[model samples]
Target: MIEGFTSSLAEVNGTRLHYVAGGQGDPVVLLPGWPRTWYQFHKIIPLLAQRYRVIAVDLRGMGDSDSPLPGTTRRPWPAIYTS
Candidate 1:
């Protein structure tokens, strides 16, 4: 057997974000796509736990977090876009 990690909810910028935390290095924010859950990164989490403090989160309207109605486009976008 092995030690376990933890998951919880965090309210950020009005959205209730669900997150899983582990490891012990620089903060690494794992932002998923619009329709995907944080579980998509389950495979990489362990590898990351070896070197980084991994934090995988379910974006607003996805997964364990609260799914609210659509909002204006002025809000934040996923971290993938380089603009």
Candidate 2:
């Protein structure tokens, strides 16, 4: 766990999404690239969190987030990322 960061799971389209959040003020959502987890932002999170609320998310099927079942249709990026 990163210092000063809190981990959480959010339900989106019946899947559990993992994320780490911290700090205050305006919210800043960090989306990682392919094959990467929220931990990728560990170094920058603290710096950004100093002035903004940082939320680093692990995209589905990547980190601790749930993976879609085989044969299921893949959702679009907009739908998957939207709250």
Candidate 3:
């Protein structure tokens, strides 16, 4: 409910990821660095949305995205980030 943006949850590799998307055009995915959530791009979303479909996501173990279970291997971390 952030103006023109829409929030959603996606399940990938058994993990649920949270994201906000808006605008229409070529797709643009935004991934925030550690300790930050999708809201970090709030101020710029509107500007980017004008020319492209902006999708800001909350990476795993941060924000509303599900955290990995204790003892889980970190090997998949790279795949998660790239995908």
| lDDT of every predicted structure (CA atoms) | 0.73, 0.88, 0.88
Q: After superposition, which runs of candidate 1 have C-alpha atoms over 4 Å from their true positions?
A: 1-3, 69-83
Task: Write model 3 residue lDDT over 43-62, tens digit each, in one string.
Answer: 99999999999999998888
RMSD of each: 4.3, 1.3, 1.6
Model 1 RMSD in Å is: 4.3
lDDT of 1 at 11: 72
Ranking by lDDT: 3, 2, 1
- Segments in model 2 whose C-alpha atoms lie over 4 Å from true places: none
- Provide the TM-score for each candidate, comma-separated: 0.75, 0.90, 0.89
| Candidate 3 pairs with clashing backbones | none
Candidate 1 C-alpha lDDT tens digits along 28-79: 8788776897788888888888888888888766789876646634555542
In candidate 3, what residue range of length 10 has the lowest lDDT sum?
74-83
lDDT tens digits by residue: candidate 2, 1-83: 87888999999867789999999999999999989999998889999989999999998888999887665446676786567
Poorly placed runs, candidate 3 (over 4 Å): 81-83
Best by TM-score: 2
